[model samples]
Target: MSNSQFSEERFQQAPVVGILRGVDHATLDRIIPIYINAGFSTIEITMNTEGATNMIQKLSEEYPQLNVGAGTVCDMDDLEEALKYGAQFIVTPITNEAIIRKCKSLNIPVFPGALTPTEIYKAWTAGATAVKVFPSSQFGIGYIKDVMAPLNKIPLLPTGGVTLENIADFFQAGVTGVGMGSSLFPKQFLKEGFEQQLFDHLKAVKSAYESVFQTA
Candidate 1:
């Protein structure tokens, strides 16, 4: 699929972007199916990961059902490399206007990280699909709520310190989506080779998200 074809509708079905960082190819191969099976629609492989470009290419081709993206894109070179390898979306840890503009020109969905109001507004004005509030754990859900009060027009995707327990609460606070990393896929499970436990955890997370939207 083309990079411009990111499905916002499909993403809203789950609205959780699973982040993979420093994961080896073998581990990625083992866990992707589990992630997909647990009802995730979006996943990003950080550019800093070893062989990230290759992994993006392979996953994009292998899992057409998944919205394969590249994260940790801090500069123009990283953006070029990600696009060259079929990254359907782009994510950054900082608000890089050049990278955001490039992704915007290509019509690829981009989420640039920001914290303060100034940075967030700057990223939104630069044409980011959504501004990611990085290290959100530092301020917690109340911070997201306060930011949304005035900047309600800007879509926010909070990353860092997100967990199944608080995922629903984040949505309630008016976030467009949430990005999860080690919280969703615990390092302990991966290190110990507890595949079944990890799969179960993902399923539980999905259930928790769905519960928030379920009709009474």
Candidate 2:
């Protein structure tokens, strides 16, 4: 595939991806557009989200331009269901080769979670497009630089504890991109009746990234 056709290329350039963890079907219809307008063409809905499979199907059909991924996924059954419901990407909190292989067979991007260098290497060898650096604050940017020094070939997506405040630091530290949840969630938007606050925050992150990475 050409660079123009790969999600990795697009994701890297986007500079940020919106992670909608623990979302429910009730609020999704109103929430998805908030993400779309936030300069986020990619979205991740955790498996534990209420009516996740149904929401994935609906979101995929509604926003054809968005890359909808299934997150917090663990087993083969969840993977199969997620794919059937139109998940464009599959992400897990662990390095499970089975889920990785299934996603590969289906030609979708797979990002398995890893904390240690050994686990990160194993995920990369298993054909993961990228390995998610979970609880990024727990390890910090130094851990990312340390890992990349040796396995520079691997693209790392640092997730967890990724607030808008600290996200730029992670990107500057060489992360492919950051996956954020609570930080990205606009609580006031839902209450104040203006969804644009959330959108603006996302755009702000993109702007920060552009200032740093010329290509972004």
Candidate 1 local lDDT, 1-216, one digit each (tens): 344457788799989999999999889889999889888989999999999999999999888889999999999999999989899999999999999998899799999999999999999999999999998989899999999999999999999978988988888777899999999989977754788999999999888877777832
Clash pairs, model 2 backbone: none
Please, what are the lDDT tens digits per residue for candidate 2 over residues 150-211?
88888999888777666767777777777877777766655435666766776787677666
The local lDDT score (0 to 100) that residue 58 gets in candidate 2 is 81
- CA lDDT, every prediction? 0.91, 0.77
Best by TM-score: 1
lDDT of 1 at 16: 94
Candidate 2 ranges with C-alpha deviation above 4 Å: 1-9
Q: How well does each candidate superpose onto the true structure, as a TM-score?
A: 0.96, 0.90
What lDDT, from 0 to 1, does candidate 1 have? 0.91
> What's the alpha carbon RMSD for model 2?
3.3
